[model samples]
Target: MNTLKWIKRILMALLLIIFLLLMAGFVFERISRSIAEKIKPDGQFAEVENHKMHYLQQGKGGPTVVFETAFDPAGHLQWYHIQQNLPKSYTTFSYDRSGILWSERGANPKTGEKMAEELHTLLEKSKAPKPYILVGHSFGGMLTRFFVQKYPKDVAGVILVDSQYPADEKYLSPQLYKMVNQGLPGGFLKFANTFGAARLMFKNMFPENNQYQYQNSVMPALLYKSADATLEEQDHMKSVKTEAAAINTFGSVPLYVITAGDKTKYDSFIKDQKIKNEMLGAWDKMQKDLLNLSTDSKQIIAEKSGHYINQDQPEVIEKAVNDMVEKVSVQ
Candidate 1:
């Protein structure tokens, strides 16, 4: 009888300890979120499909340049330096998709077509003049393509900054795809964020790249919606690809494909010599294929950079946009 009572007491003690730890985590998470909200960048909000969408705009007048970002917590910040460097004679805009950064999650399904539509509505409601010169990086490249297909009249030209291609699944090894698709389960990530685990990981992740505004703007988005949105997009990549494949030719849309020339970057992600070689070959083929989409297309290789060319070679991006703007002016 005494032994049984001791076991029961120990179990109860353990449960109480866990309860206290969870409560502490919840409190910490709430405090961190409040702090992040206080320091976020100054940006305007517009209602799209009954949800608040955040955007940053600069400069004035035509032709408006729209920035579409990757599946990153930094949102529009990915294009910050390039956007800031552009001449004020042309207007520029960058935005967080719904459930990203400061934007509220909308009711529509998280598919590229729906997102393309939401972007159109957001542009119209915000009074950002068009036709826009769409600049897309990584996953944003997919969204930009969808936008062009759905609303070709809204876009004057396209600049793909190391964009994601529709046939990526065909080229990427199963191991790499599996690693990307299942890196971390979203439900677990959401649970971790709620209990402050995500915040701790985020702090460790960005320890070396400290900037006041970057931390202020990115941390909240990382804690709030980055995981869920990322997972949803990955889950629906098949549909996104299908939609992307629909529009084979842009019919002289003035496309500019900026490819990262550093093939060695894949060395870190892929260990197998054979698979890595295959991926590199496939990557080069796809980039070349993107050039054929528009008759007036040109390609620029950012030889010094890796995947994030905007970060490594902002000058290249700035020149690309200015060149596109100049081309549009003559048309």
Candidate 2:
């Protein structure tokens, strides 16, 4: 009789704890949504296929500079510093991908081709004049490459900033590759977003300036809309490589490849210098190969920087884009 009573009491305590957690999660979610609503979007919107796409544009003229964000969910905000420094004579633009901050969730699969098509449409709808100079960072580089391949006539030049090579997986060890490709758990993110846990976690760690406000506003939205889309994009990695292989070259269309200089952190996760060196070598070789993509291409090493060159050395990106703009202007 005593044992039965104790068992019942323990079971009841467990149930109560679970109930409290669920309730707390619900309350946090409500608080997060309210905070998100108070934040204003940084840019204007363009309607594409009846969905609103958010974008920011500065300056005013021909051969518009279009910036694409890295794989990180922050979107156009990643280029905030570099974009601000560009000349006012030439138009510059940046935008969030579908399912990212300030953009409607897209129904189509998040493949490189689909993203490129959507970007093309967004520009057309937004009335961004043609003869564009596409500047892409990281995964955005792949999308920009796809855009150039599909609409070669519209693009005057390309700048890839610490971009992801299509065959990147081939250079990675099997263990590393598996770790890189493994998808984050969407359900956990969704739960965290619902409970405002993600918001609290990132609020303090956000970058300086006005970035904290931006990050706080969009962190939950990204968790809610982008978690699954990110996974879906990962699944299509092979297809991205295949498409890249098919394009082979970019002809003489003025390409600049900016590679990161700091390689000491490459294998920090595993704390293995050998693995890090190998990965860094592969990355350098890949960046060099990017030169083969264009007859007029060159590679610049951001000697003081890492993968996030825009943040580490915004001046480097500024110079590269300025140079590309000058090159296109003459041609």
Candidate 3:
């Protein structure tokens, strides 16, 4: 009888502990989200598509330069340096991707081809110029690559930053590929898109192993916007197919590629010897593949910079871009 009573008490204690932890987590998430909402963009616009797209435009010249921060957590403000110092001759405008940062949600994949089409429509509606230089990072690189193929006559030069093409699916992990591939139709897209669902995912995934306070902004906050561009559930899949089709169409337009350097170089945090070796080996293989892919374009690796190479080595990116512009201009 005494033993049974002790077991019941222990189980009750554990349940109470779990309940307290869940409540604390809920409170912390609310606080973090309230903080990230405060960061502001340099300029803002309600795009012709009826979705708001944030932007920052500066300078003036022959071929206007447009920068796309189509990656996570950022709006138009991520171009802190390029907007400040990309030469006086070129007009530069950096903007948030739809469904990211301050922009209104619009679509999935947000391919360069579809985005380029939208921007072109916006340009026509807003009377924005054409025959401009295009710059993109990561996924944005895929977009720029597609734009050059789709509208070769409209682009003068292109610069792609730390763009992860030719790399295997290992970097993104099979699970993420599964989520993006499976969950779109599995219904996580519609459900987790609201601000509440996003807060839960971002906070829980913060993993006690890594620490980054949501002091300002988080990638998922971009989920607050609605996707007006998607008509059907599979429109997202169509976007993927459309982007793949665009890849089959790369043109001979002036091109520059920036290969990124991963920081497994100084990574002592990796405890397992086998995982460390695998990381180092993977980084070396990616470097070799990048060098081979840089044939027509000027390719340089940004050292110690991981996925967000532009944010890590923006000045290096800026110089490489300017050099490419001068070289292509002379050609």
Q: How does each model score on lDDT?
A: 0.80, 0.78, 0.57
- TM-score ranking from best candidate downward: 2, 1, 3
Off by more than 4 A, model 2: 1-15, 204-206, 209-223
Q: How well does model 2 score by local distance difference test? A: 0.78
In candidate 1, position 205 carries an lDDT of: 31
Q: RMSD in angstroms, candidate 1?
A: 3.2
TM-score per candidate, chains pooled: 0.87, 0.89, 0.67
Better of 1 and 2 by lDDT: 1
What is candidate 2's lDDT per residue for 81-185, written digit by digit as tens?
Answer: 677788989889898888777788768677778888888998887777778999888888877778988899999999999888877676777876676556566
Give the candidates in order of lDDT, highest first: 1, 2, 3
Best by lDDT: 1
| Clash number by candidate, in order | 0, 0, 2
What is candidate 3's lDDT per residue for 161-269, written digit by digit as tens?
Answer: 7654533344435643343334233255444433255445544322232222331234444334422222232354445545543363334566666766765643555
Q: What tens digits encode model 1's per-residue C-alpha lDDT throughout 1-331? A: 9999999999999999999999999998888777777655557888998998988888888888999988666677677667768898988999888887678887888888899988888888878877899999988987787888888887899999998887666766787556544544668877888888776766533324443356444654455566577667767777887888776787789999999998787877778888778877877888888898899999999998888888778899999999999999899
